[model samples]
Target: MKKIIFSLLVLAASFSANAQVDRSTMPKAGPAPEINLSKPQSFELKNGLKVIVVENHKLPRVAYTLTLDNPPIQEGDKTGAATLSGALLGKGSTSISKDAYNEEVDFMGARINFGSQYAAASGLTQYSDRILELLADAAINPNFTEEEFNKEKALLIDNLKTNEKSVSAAASTASRALLYGKDHPKGEFETPAGLENVTLADAKAFYNKAFIPNNAYLVVVGDVDFKNIKKIVTSNFKDWKKGSALPAAFTTPKNVVSTEIDFIDMPNAVQSEVIVENLVSLKMSDPDYFPVLMANQILGGGGEGRLFLNLREDKGYTYGAYSSIGNDKYGMTSFSASASVRNMVTDSSVVAFLEEIDRIRETPVSEKDLKNAKAKYVGSFVRSLEQPATVARFALNIETENLPEDFYQNYLSKINAVTIADVQRVAKKYFLSDNSRIVIAGKGSEVLSNLENVSFKGKTIPVKFYDKEGNAVEKPKYEVALPEGVTKQTVLNNYLEAIGGKDKVAALESLLMVGEGSVQGTPLKLTMKKTNKEQFVQMIEVMGNVMSKQVLNGDTAVITAQGQTVTPTPEQLKDLKAESAIVAELNMLDDETIKLEKIEKVDGKNAYVLALNEKKKAFYDTESGLKIKEETTQEMQGQTFVQTVLFGDYKEVKGVQFPTKLSQSMGPQNIEFTFSEVKVNEGVTEADFK
Candidate 1:
């Protein structure tokens, strides 16, 4: 009772003191906290493999990271050899079956991963010895069987096929190719032909040549004795042979002479991928490193950045905009600002990016931005120090990047010391606005015209066309001359005849489609039902749970997503009513607002383009007379969304042909649905539209 009374008195006194103090001015920030960095113990093996170990007994866990610091090698034709070899590693060693190896790792609750030049393993500290032994065995004696090689190669091919249609992937490839010559190691992307050229022998050769230990560093962190770890590493890796020394000299690629737009055409794209980049020679050891870091942070490092504010929050052109500056010890890296934006605003987005970048380069950042950026960095850096692996990484960077031992120790101080003038100076030097490549991978038909006319500061940014592979090409011809006597009604009639007959389509009273697809690997079931009486229902289910549902019943249209149901706005209701018909093509034939535009390529085949409205377009195969694709743009909650649907693999249902495969894109995610069952005038009932 006495202690409680004393504590209450103390609390009352503290409040009285606080009430007496001034509350008008903001308090000054205190000095940066000191970081307690653990000095890693090190040893070297006979095979020239250096091992560094950091001890932390706070947690009963251990991690080992082995990195081969080899110089970059240009794999001209066999570009995928290294990648395939990396995937083949960590599967099993000579003495262990793949299944047995994986089972043991899983049993121990450990993670083991391998790449072309690196291997990492971690688990409970009690399993440290076995984990290290397994890591060394897998890294040194990988079982590169013919079966595994074939499987990995086929999977790689499938991945490349997916990337071929990805606008962001194309932009990344084009940006690298434009910034660095395609022959350079930094720029060469693996192609399907390259994958075909890579034989099993090439993968083995790359493994033998590149995965050496002479220039390697193994960082062991977590609860472990340095002496025991050194002995274990020596015992396991002693037999591994060192390869020949890598060549130190390599040529760095140069940026373009002047700012120009390098546009790659992706006709199926609903949005544009834009990148503004320039080459820089910044390294961690450079004096401008801290300044450049602060500059990029103020420009576009996170949600509070100028780019994100201007492009996403203010302009609403994209969901997010970001920039990154790379630091390479090899004297070549890029400073890039990038965004995925709406197709129609691609040109405006580019201008916005340039403006923000130029603004940062020309003007000094405010003191508030500098202080906030420093605080962000200090907080993140301090928080990261809680991980034992971060200490190991810092020690490794000091060794690999040739930095002073006290570099990370003085990190916060350096960031704090960076003045606003220093940020502007470094930004001006590294963020080259005058000589940069604006690489845009987008729909040329929608963006090229406005992009050609985009000018900044009295200078036009010339638009140069390129294929997806970054090869220079002639300007794309978006439209072709229509064949003689082709009209909107003629195309509609051809589609109606191609599906079945106009009479059969009109005779169809109701339709139901049940399909399955996956989003981010989660399986989903889609059910769509429609009737000629202007009643429709669409539902998506995951694991027997309804994810979303939409219903159009006579005069009432409503949507329910994740248990929240809302009535559609008048405009949305009009659009839903337009799409509610069972036979949309029959209604479209009579709708005078829909107009036949021109012929363009859809999936490498000619298709007649039709403008259904200002926000919607439809594509029909010119030869097959089938509706192939449809694109719609909508505005919801002050944000614009572009959704695309691709129809294919038509199968007969009763007397009319219906699409069995549907590929739909919701923003950046693509879901391909395969219809397993279709019922015509049999399954759908009036109650389904409730």
Candidate 2:
């Protein structure tokens, strides 16, 4: 009896211990610390090197950041020159080739990066004590080899070319130009010609003028011993002479008094790109910054924010939408939101965005909204401590912005202090729906026609198309012609088999394939995933790296890439539907006579041509026949390339025929293959497309 009683007692104790809740019936955390912050310790070396040290011995590693405040490179002509110069600096240093430098850095587990901004040239490094010397080498001994410079320059040009094709980039680029005059530093655009002029001499000159230790500040944080770090820096950078201090100059233009409707034409865009931007005044240290930040959070910050709740959850007009205030050095802030809506609803969506903006400015936020926003901001701020790098970055921002060291410590209190009156005042003052610069980049013909003939402050504004150089751009010619004799059915079958096998492909409700290849002598990879309703591609090497396209009800098409989500242009959407219908028709083909036409030179290469037609004469219809086109091309990478495939083949799998092979030329040398190991339709779920 005693043994049984003791076992019951032990089990109860175990359950009680396991069921303990950390927060249940516990006292709430007290208000944050309100302690005064100590000023940063600083000293200047004889050669003009400025050192700012913040000692925090909590972690056993150090982070070093060097910044050279330089003037914006020659105003309007070559905006990206400084950026290109910074990139070229780290390609090769005095004692190392580009490849050798990359290998050494990889082996040492060290990282180095340089970039040019409006006011500074910055380089950052973080590593243990053992790799500090290598970091110094990278900073002080940049060789700027001609070979590497040329290679990097070409790559930059290619990147710019790729950006031009992106809708989001085009919208942002156009918006900046409209908000700030094209000549302003904040609004300047980088052109291909500007990149073309960045010679090795130009990079060397920029480096010589800006990379002076006397005109630079070195901030060292973490487990760094000041004495040891100073010694290492002196040894690596002592001989560097001081250069002339560049003048500090920047101008933020007054907001335009009238609404401007700028349009960028993408002929076959599946969705419209929209951005409504207007200048706002909220400096980093201003009393209104805290309140405004909280207000924007409530207005349209994230999934739970106002914009998302209205546009996505309630109306289903878009997948997602949000707004933000980008606080910069010059106190420039703009609230913007984007969404991809059907062509018919394009105008209605714009009306909704504007209506929400106006509503916020006119009415005070509810107590519930204010509380949720504050809680989210405070909670997220506390959670950010889980990442060391993020903590360091926040610390750096605090220092750079000249905010109090304990600024973040009292973050919640400051946000909580903001009242509904404060929210209304900032919104009224900053949110200018009347004069906002509304820019749309998409199939202008279809979208513009549907929009209520909008006038900027009552003046009619005409839509215009401009190239990257801000000059009028012509419409692109899209010519896709299939070789004669190939029937649509045969082409469809070949394409299906090439991907995998029809049975397996059809069974798969969704599929994802990743491929690696070479471009301009560099290895690159891309990942693509597809389902009946949507497709997504991550081209690992590009800006706006996440791109997605989707189909709805087998008729409408939508695409989200870069920062913009758009539905296809009217014509493009029409084409998309036609393509879908063709695919369906191809799926029905059983047996067809396919013939390989004679080899023909295409794009400077001999390509094998194939044709397909219905086998039975009774089923043949010249008007209804669909053509199939296939070509083979050689791909190269570095010193190696393959005279591989760009061919389409059909094979049977699970009693269905499908295309299984897809090959494309990557550059001068490499060919990429996208192979599927298994594709089975076991049962596709609706959530898979989402």
Candidate 3:
């Protein structure tokens, strides 16, 4: 007890001595901390499969990664050959059935995945040998059965269809097509026709041709010993015969002569996607690498980036704006800044994006910005050290990309050394604002007119039209002059007549509908009811519970969600008044404020557009006169966004035409509701609205 008391007194005295020295002055950061990066021991098998082993005994776990480090191969007519080869590689080995292999891997609680260019497996350290053997068998002795091939092909086609209507997918396809050209393998996407052209034989041929060990790398990290892993790797992968050298013939993609606009029109688009991109040849080994990354970080790499601050925080144009700069060793890489913004501000958003890009190039970044960028990179690098996989990746990168042995160890110092001038220099060399493709995939009919006259630095940037497939086309005329005989009343009357008739629609005193739908893949049930008294109620249920409910009783509107009830805003009240009607178009016919705006194409079909009181726009197909789509501005959870509701699969419900499918896309997710049954003038009462 006396000794403990003396030790406590000494400790307190030591703290008092240090605390009395200085409390106000900023302490200097000590010298740079030494980095003890694990150096991987490596070897090679007879067939040239390079093996890199990194040992970390902290946990009883192991990870194995086998990468075929080869350049892009041209598949020509077989665009998805390599993709199929990778998909079918992990089905089974010659010695084991597919089910048995999967069962054993699962029984061992390990994960094994085979890709066209790589294979990976990770689990407990005790199962490392077996996992490695499984990987080898899957890679070297893969059995390409016809049934599995057909299944994979079918899945690919199904995914293609799912992505067909996705705006983000369209943007990706267009960007790749523009940057790499559709003919290049880097840009080429597998289509239904192209996938159909691929066969089991073709997939096998691609596997035999590209899955060679001459340019392969195997990385094993975690609780592993170099000697033991070396033995396991040698026995399994020794038979992976090499000699499949990559074809050297390739073409590098080049940027445009000058800054220009490339537009792809999606008539249903509510938000415009802007991508400011250019070709850049950047590698990790280059001296400019760190500077380029820092420059991007300052410009648009994160929430604090200039792009996000200007567009989202300052202008309220988008939810987020981000930039990415890729360093591809085998193919042309790109530097891009992108955002999806409101339709009304599409031109301003584009201008803001370009100005930000140009401003970063012209002016040097502030000291604060530079400091923040450095701090972020430093923090990220430190956090990455906590992961064994990161260590393995770094080691593999050192060998494959030909970096200095101490590159990762010196990463922080290099990032800290980048100056404002270095940032500006690399920005000028890589960003290429003056020679970039301002790719805008949007509803061009609404934005093009506003954008074509938009001037940057007092010079107007002209717009060029392109189809969704990246094929250049002429500009589409938005406003089609109607003949003198076709007046607003004529169009409205045509629509009313097309739907069952004026009297029949007028007889729709009430409606009650129950339907099933999906929201980002979660199943939801919806209930909607309306009465002739301009009152409506909507409820959304998930898993047999009401998730949200919107109600309009005469002039008052309220919405209840997540156990909270709130009155609708004035703008929401206005919008609800229109929706309260059994049919919005029916109410529009009586209102003089609404007018026939113009004739535009909806999915390539001529449609009559009606300006619905400046809050919404309605498109009715010209020949059929059926209301096909309606776009409206909505505010939810304090965010203002555009909601586009597509009406299709029309069927006569009693005396009126009713749409069976309703699709709504808000922000990024698309939700669809297909009604199995809808009844008009049935099961709707005033009590429901109350």
Q: Estimate each model's TM-score.
A: 0.93, 0.64, 0.90
**Candidate that beats the other on TM-score, 1 or 2, i.e. the better one:** 1
| Cα TM-score of candidate 2 | 0.64
Over 548-659, each residue of candidate 1 has an lDDT whose tens digit, in order, gives 9989988898899999999999987887787877768888888898899999887678899899999898889999999999988878669888899999999998889999
**Which candidate should be chosen as best, given TM-score against the real structure?**
1
Off by over 4 Å in 1: 1-30, 553-558, 568-580, 681-690
What's the best-to-worst order under TM-score? 1, 3, 2
**Overall local distance difference test of candidate 3:** 0.87
TM-score of 1: 0.93
- lDDT string for model 2 (35-113, tens) is 3332356666778876666556665655666776444434456566566667766665677677887786677665666
Report lDDT (Cα) of residue 677, candidate 3. Answer: 76
| Top of the candidates by lDDT | 1
Error of 3 at 650 (Å): 2.5
